[model samples]
Target: MARRVLLWVGDEAVHEAAGRVLHSVMDAQRAEELMRSYGEQLIERGRQQGREEGREEGLSRGRAEYILRTLALRGVHADEAARERILGCTDVATLDRWFERSLNATTLSEVLDDLAQ
Candidate 1:
């Protein structure tokens, strides 16, 4: 005598449906393939985000350094403490105004004034 299996599709019970359709399927191998594909996709997305973050950091540092160098050329002398303050600033609009004033600022006070506004 053969064994029988029943599966409920909607409102009717179908006999031997799974045994007839999925009798030769491999479940473990298919699951492993899907897991590996998902891991690779996650790693690629993380790398792209890291690269973009690094690019933004480098641009901000470069702009800050340019402002300091321009201030030095214009005879605006800032000590180590003031230099640290300027480099720590992250606002782009404020930095742009400071950069413009650095070209003509004759004293450190004038440079700080531009940064304040």
Candidate 2:
């Protein structure tokens, strides 16, 4: 029987092997705990990044809308291409400058000028 063979090998040898196995199991459990903690931190960081990107995108959309509305209220007729350029803009300062120009613009081109820059 396997028990008889193990007994014949003596108690000292059996105890040493059993101790090694206990240590190996403990080490494996500690490594697993550390991995789980690290994974949670990475997930939190990804979520934070997503929120920041969403906020920035919303700001850009708001700026673009403000620019278009200002042009319309001033009776400036921006064609389709000019409308696209205004709506597509994301730079807040540049959008503000264009909105200011719209107040004094007699033609769509005046408000949309320097847009290529």
- Candidate 1 residues 41-66, lDDT tens each? 55676798899987876777777788
Which candidate has the highest lDDT of all? 2
Instruction: Give stretches of model 1 more than 4 Å off.
Output: 1-26, 114-117
lDDT (tens digit, per residue) of candidate 2 on 33-72? 5445545555677799999988977887787777777777
TM-score of each: 0.64, 0.64
Candidate 1 lDDT trough over 10 residues, lowest sum: 1-10
Backbone Cα, N, C clashes tallied per candidate: 0, 0
Q: How many pairs in model 1 have backbone atoms within 3 A of each other, for residues 3 or more apart or on separate chains, i.e. clashes?
A: 0
Question: In terms of TM-score, how similar is model 1 to the real structure?
Answer: 0.64
